[model samples]
Each structure stands twice: as C-alpha cells, then as structure tokens.
Target: MTTDFGLKETGYIAPSFAEILDGVEDDYRTRLGDDIALTSNAYLGIFARLMSDASYDLIQQQEQIYYSGFYSTAVNSALDRLAGNISLTRKVDAPSHAEVVITTEGEYLIQAGEKFETEDGLVFDLTEDVITSKQSDGAFQGTGNVECEETGEFTNVPANTITLFANPDEDFISVTNPRPAGGGQDYEDDETFRKRLIMENAARPGPTEPGIKSALMNLNGVKQVGFIDNDKYKTDEYGNPECSVHIYVLGGNDDEIAKTLIDKCAAGITLAGSIVKEAPDATGKLKEVKFDHAQQHNIYVKIDVSINDDWNSDAGVDDIKQAICDEINSLEMGQRVNFTRLYSVTYDVNGVDDATIAIGSTKDKLADQNISIGRSEFAHCDPGDVEVDLIGL
Candidate 1:
C-alpha cells in the first residue's frame, strides 16, 4: 500500500519547499496559481482523500479488487535471476494473436563483444570488455551538463566533446576527465574522482530501471523477466485494443514451472493457462497439453473448433468446420497441432454463455478422468477472439 520513494538519508522529507513560503510573504504568493496552490496544499493533507475516492470508484468499476498493477523489485529481481536468455518473436504460434511475444528472457546472459570488419569479412569476438560511464559534480549528487577544455599537456580543443579514457594510465588522463555525452573521460582532481565514484556506484538497471514497479511476475522461484504491454495498439476501429501484459522467462523447457505460473496468472480470472510443448516436426507448432482442473475437479483436454457467422455465410459454418476439422484431422498422431477448446464462451459478452459446439470427449467422461475446462465466464470481453486458458496442470 505504501509507495517507496527512494531516500538516501534520514534528512529526506517531502522537501516542504512549498510550505516554507506559506506564511512567509504575500509578495511571493503571486507565483502560486489556483491549480498549483491547490495541488501543493492538497499534497500535504487530502492527497490520501483523493486516493481513497479513486480507489473506491475503481473497485466499483471492477477494474481490480485491490490495485495489483504496480509490482515490486523483489519480484523483478527474482525474474531477472531466473531468465537466462533473451529471445523474442512476433508470432509464438499460428493461433496465438498476442501482439508481442517473448519466448524467453532471463535464460541467456549477454556479455561485451567487438565487431570488426576486415577485407576477409566481418569478425566478432566476445573477449573485449564494455563498460558504461557517466559524469557528475562532486558538490552534489546531481550532475548537470559539463564542459571540457584540453590544453598544454592535454589534447586541448574548443567545443570538443568530453571523452572517458579507457586506458587512463597510458595517457596523462586520470578518471577526472569530463567526457562529453557518450564519450569517455579521464580525471585527476578529487572532485572529479568523487563524481566518477558516484556515477560508478549508481545502480545501472536496464530497461525497467530500479526503484520502479517491475512488470515481471515471479513464477514459483523463477522470474518471468520480460513483459509485453499491448494496451497501445490502435485497432481497425481507431480505438486501443484490449490488452494484457504477458510475463515470461527466456530459457529452458521447464514445463512444470511455466504451467505453475500460467495457473497463478489465471486465478479468479477468465484468462486460463495453457501448456505448450515443442513440436519436433514444425517450427511454430507446439503440442497443447491437457492438465488437471483442480478447482473444478475434472480431467480437461484439447478440443476441436469451428467458427460460424451466418452473416458471413459466404464463409459458411460447415465450410469453416470442414476446413478446421480437416486440418486437425490431417495431423499425424503426436505431432504438434493447433489445439483449441470446443465449448469456450466468446470473449465479447461477459457472463453470457454462448455455448459453441464441442467435440472430443464428454464433460462427464472428462470429470471421471479428473480434468475439466476452466470457468467460461469473462469480464471486459473482446469480440470474436476466443481466448482460452491452456496450462499443463
């Protein structure tokens, strides 16, 4: 419930710089306009009131019971450790309509390398070391834009950018040199040295920086280090499409781990978890795995699908069924096939069970076998998109 505002020292407060002037002078009060004054004073008192009001409205709208959008670093760090690779894809599978998909994230470790071109061709070697550096002022923690002037023993120039010397000992340049933007610098002064120290010691968080809510979700102990935010895409109707943030790790085939995460993500929600296995025969086909629906106490399974729109009868229901069924039937046993559920409710209508045709095994048989389909009701449904939760229980 509390937002952590990173404070380096005990003296840190809300910096009542605004309150300091409250009764000090009416002369300077001209600077505070209606909105600014209201916001500044409100921040000291009724900001919590505003939050309570917004939270109550959010709860009423069914956005979330408790706000779960913000995440913590513990979760992010956990995911970072678990993901060892960084692989991305536009299409995870033919049926997967995810806007962006991350096949793996933390599974691969990246290191510094050099790429050089010669008459023979291009050569790349990972032996080289790559480091990131920044410049700051010793007087304060913040470092504004700095200027550099080289003279006499130094390579003096006018309007030249600063450079950080990779090998300062070889040149007279010490770590004190002020590098221009994206340039390396060498410095000799203690002040500059202190600046370098601060820059070096500062945490260098990639992508989702430290102190920010991590988009990553921890699955078991492994962290799903990568996430895709799909709320920005505008659809054909010139409106943003409904979207979700998918968290995933980027290495190894831990079917058990992946399944566990999917289940957690689908909890108390219509979004179900589906486990996918790598198919040996094709590049995109991943075998759908049926897992135990423990909550429903049934044996769930893969089912065939056929889309029918009498309005689009030009593309008739029988034709759609024949085409889809024929493709499914054409698959060799044990081969990766496009697996879908037969009796899933459409995503367009919330709590409305528009039962579609289902085939394979009966619900009673599936229950006898200890597998069951996930809850079919949904919220904030998107039309025509039959999003089914697949997970290996």
Candidate 2:
C-alpha cells in the first residue's frame, strides 16, 4: 500500500522498499523487545528487507492493474477493447484506390476486373467496365475506378505510374492515372489511435462545428481541415449563402468526406464546397453533400548561410530544406507562417552560425516578409524548390 494519501481518481503513490522496510522493522520492535539486534546487516533485519522488496513489487503491480482499466493509460489489447465501447475500430492496412483513364486508337471496350500495373509492380483492378466513346479526331477514351491489389502505404502510386497493363490488350493504346492515388495506409499505431479515441469521448461527431472537425481529423489520410460558418441574412463575403457551413479539407476520400457531411451536419443546413456527392441518410434517401478540396499553396525557400568548412554542406543543405518544409507542413489550414520561424528552422542544422532567409508563395515573389495563407490553402514545399547557398570558410 501507498504511504502518501490520495484519491483513486487522481493517482496513488506506491511506497518504496525503504519505506516498507522501516514499517516492518517498527512492527517487529513493537512485538519483540527493543533488545533484539535489528540492524540492516543482521539476519533478522535482512529477512525483513526481503519481505519489504516483495511487498513493493506487489503494490506496484496492483497500481498498474488499476490504471489499465482507464483508456488514457491503457496499452495494446486494453486500448483496443476500450475503443470498442465507442464503436471505433483501429485502422489496419487498408488498400488504396484511384481513378484511371484508358485510351485507345480505335473503339475499345474495357471490362470489369481488368488489371493494371505500375512500374514497381503494384497491381490495381478495375471496379467497373467502360466502353470508350470515339472522338471526332479518331481517339477513344473512357474513365473507370480502380482499387489496389495490396493493402499498405506502398500500394499508393503517383500520377501516370500505372502505365503497363497486367493483361496487355493490343487494342488499348495506353492506360494512365490523371492524379496521384491515395487512401492506402499501414496499421495504425497506439499513439494515433489513442488521440482519436480521446476525441470520441469529447466531440463524438454531432451537429456542431467542433464535432465535424473532430470527425474529419480522425479519418485516415486527412491532413488539415478548416471551417467557416455564415449565418447572416444574405450571402457572406466568401460567397457562402446565408445559413451555410463551408469546410475546406486537404486530404481524405471524397466519398468519405461527403458521407461525413451528410451524417454529422444538421438537417436543412446548406453545405458549401467545390465537390459534391450524393449520399444516403438514415432513411436511405439520397442527399447531395458538398465540401471544398483545399488547394496547395507551394512555398519556396531561399537561404544564404555562412558555415564552417568542416560541415558537410551537401548533406546539411538537404537537412535544412527538410526541416523548413516539415515545420511549414505541420501547420494546419488558416495558421500563419511567422517571419521569425525561418531562422529557428535553419539554425537547427549543425555548424550554421548565421542565415538570411526569404520565402514566398511563388518563386518570383520571394521576400523577407511573411505571407498570410488563406483558409482554403495548404502550404507545400518540394526539395527541388528549396534553394540553399552556403559560404564556407
């Protein structure tokens, strides 16, 4: 048992071996006479120490067992069990899916289950069959849906990566993806799952702004979410109609985004976004849902730093660029990029004493001033776009 007094809801302090040993020795003196040799080196005192060590271990184990019942302190199997109470399951290795366009020189008929492959050998299967419509210029093209053959992050391919057809058809001139594939994910770890689980207890995705944001953040592949509400009598400055909710989302499946809007928002409240999808409600009636897909605001960084000749400029340059990009991308939508932050991220690289940094939304407008990002824009940076010039001693 713990010597410190406390409530069970807060936490308990377990007694140490020294404390337990003193308690055991005091009890022995009360029963036996004080004339007994109870020094730590003696046989009787050593026996008491062994008993104290055993009691200490048991009490610590008891404390852990008690704490494990709560979701906040639980791990692995216990965390999974607690999530079940709120109807939330941990996200496992789910397959990615994409949209593909199949082209042909002549009238081509594509069937469902047709397999397409990437250069790395990631396979994708067509969800439905489509027949190409002949254009006036003599080319035929048709659009179809595809899902990855494997379930993991590796299955997520880039634009035009799916060039080769698993079963080659001479009639098909080419197959390609217009946009990069998404939604493939690995097994969710404990920390990410725990955050989502905690949100479930707080917001629970009801007819509220916070609830909607919380629900979207919990979705896989979602990076940032921004919300704006218009309750005026007329159209708002952002062009949202009166009594509308406008959400700008950077990532997540379009269908899932639409479905979430349908489920969480209040009935009769107008939703605003660029993309619209028809989803079913509790009564199985089709409802049109809308949400805007946030556009990427590419950020270009230019750095002039004087460093020691001993520092490896080649490797350290890349590290500086990555650090700047990581810090910027970590920010959610509508967050400001302060001017002073550039110095902090650049200095994080070793052997860099002084630096002058300039940033801009476009490469042509690079300046020392900070740029304010709008609610519907996400800050992005490419390694190629980052410019670092070092003056070595």
Candidate 3:
C-alpha cells in the first residue's frame, strides 16, 4: 500500500531513497549472505539512486500542495465573506484645509485658482476667487479658504507661515493662514483594519451602543466615538424634550456622522448637537433636519523621566521626551491616561530607569490620578506640555 505523504502524522519523517536502499541491502545481506555489489556502476545502485531522487521530488510536491491550500487568497477571501468579515482595503486620504486672509494694497481681484506656498514647500490652492475691498485701515482685505494640494496632517502648520504667493502679479497681496489646517489623515494600517472588522462582526443590529460605535467607526479617520444617552439632561433651546443621543466623536466628517445618526437611529429620536441637513419629503418639498453634536474639551498631560547611568548618550534626552509625547498623542478620545502605562513606556525606553508622571500638573503627581475625560472631551498632549527631567544616577 502506498503511504499518503500529505496525511502523514505530526513529526513524521519521509524515508529517503538512500535509507530505503540501506534497508533493502540489509534484507538482501540477511537472505543471500551479502553477494550483491552496491557500487555506483552496478544496476542495483543506479536504480536505487534514481528511485530516491523521485521519492524526494514527490514529497516536495506533496508538501507544496498541502501548504498552498492553507494560504490561498481566493479561499481565504471566500471564507471571510462567508463569516461576514470585512476584507482589508486602502483607506481614503483626507485633505487639510485652512482659511487664508488675503490683504492687498488696493481693490484686487484674486482668481479662484490662485496658489500659495509655505516655507516647507507645501502648496495650497484657493477654493474661491475673492474681490478684496478697502478695510477700515485703507488696505484691501478678503478672506479665502485654501486646501493643501497634497493630503496628510497639516494641522501643525503655524499661523502667518503662508506668505509666498505663486503668482508674482499678486505680489501686493499678503496671505496668511489665520488658523492651523486640520482634517488630514493617512491610510489605515493592518492592525486598525482588523480591529474594525472585529468590531463590525461583533455589533448587533439596531441603535445600540455597539452598533452606533461600529457605524461611526466605518467612517474614515474616526479614531474614537462615544455615545451619551442624555434623557435626563436639560431640554434643548427649541423647548424640545431632552431625550437625545449625544454623540461625541473624535476624527471624522461632522456632516457624515450626523447623517449616520439619522439613518441608524429610530424615528423621533432627538439628536443633541446642531447638525443641519436638508431632507425632501414625499411631496418633493425640502425640509431641514437638525441633529446635535457633542462639544470637545482638550486634556493636557505632563511627565518627568529619570535615566540610568548606563544610558546611551546618542539617544538624546529629547528622544525620551518625544517618546512620551508620542504615547500621549496616540491615545483615543475620552480614553483615560493611565499613569502606570506612562511609567511602563518610560521603563521600556532603552535608557530610562524610572519615571514620574502627572496628567494635569507637575507637583500634583501623587495626588493627581489618571485623567478621565468626559464623553465630549478628548485627550491631547502637546510636545510643549510634556516636560521631561532626566535624573542621571
């Protein structure tokens, strides 16, 4: 009977031709007193070698076929679909936009497609043309919104940095971004994608907490989401009863979020924040629907680290500070900032031996506990806010 190489037991070893030949020779020796010559020139030796090579090739082919079945993309994709698992795909890029205030010597007509650049070579294009009129100071001023040509986190661009105009003819116009650009993001990574899949699969159908969270998470750039059942809260300005769902979202389009709430929530469910959208009834008349959104509160973090004597000098103290800042920056909205986690990050550093961390204040390290942000609040730690003191011992 032929052995099934693919069905072999765990840790099973396929017998090589050489090993089989040895067994055959041993049987021949026992039966015929070692009369056969096992030289390479002999027919027996040549036949045994050829059979051995064929056996090795057969085993390799069987192994390939066995492993290929497990890793086949088509099979995995089909299985994932059957299990209602979402496949990984590239996330859309979000653009960064800022409002630019254009100042001119006299009444100047700025075209809609006018371009400006930052010192770091990031170009921005005007969304609309503006005719600047003379201001109280006798200088022509008009506000035009600009969007970054390339998308990805332009929130760090400082105010008054956009001074270079692409058109020399518009040299008289002085342009500056009054506020930092925001709403830019990169593609989602594998881990984040997998987590989303898990969340989606686990969510039950309806306007439940998990379902609402899952729906909001499907939107691009949504880092965190919180749902507050405000049945007991004060009534709205319009004198409507306060049985509303207050959605506190971190990172995502406000309009889209509001729409999602309208779709997923039950009819007559009052949404808390003001998100106005036009809806058409069966009569073809357009009616406006207003939903409420939660406000944002920023939470600050403060940390101090101590380094060991054997710390690497090349890995500057600034690196440690930046590392701590990065940890805080990676936190999701409304997530608590655990002091022990910060301590763990400091200890994980190559040179750091110990650390003392405070969320809101420096001297209040022991008394002040982990920061617990409200549903409407998000935790943010500026690099400037993170103060690191390296105590070398």
Q: What are the lDDT scores of the predictions, listed in order?
A: 0.26, 0.81, 0.63
Using alpha carbons, what is the TM-score of model 1?
0.15
Pick the lDDT winner.
2
In model 3, the Cα lDDT at residue 203 comes to: 86
**Alpha-carbon RMSD, each predicted model:** 26.7, 4.6, 7.9
Query: In model 2, where do residues sit more than 4 Å from their true spots?
Result: 1-10, 14-63, 66-72, 117-122, 134-139, 150-167, 178-180, 233-237, 304-319, 345-355, 382-393
- What is the per-residue lDDT of model 3 for residues 197-313, given as tens digits with 9 covering 90 to 100? 656768843477788788777765566777667665677554445777666666655445555665566667766544465655445665445543333444445556666666777
* Per-model TM-score on C-alpha atoms: 0.15, 0.76, 0.62
Q: Candidate 3: minimum summed lDDT over ten consecutive residues — where?
A: 70-79
Steric collisions counted per model: 41, 1, 5
lDDT of 2 at 142: 90
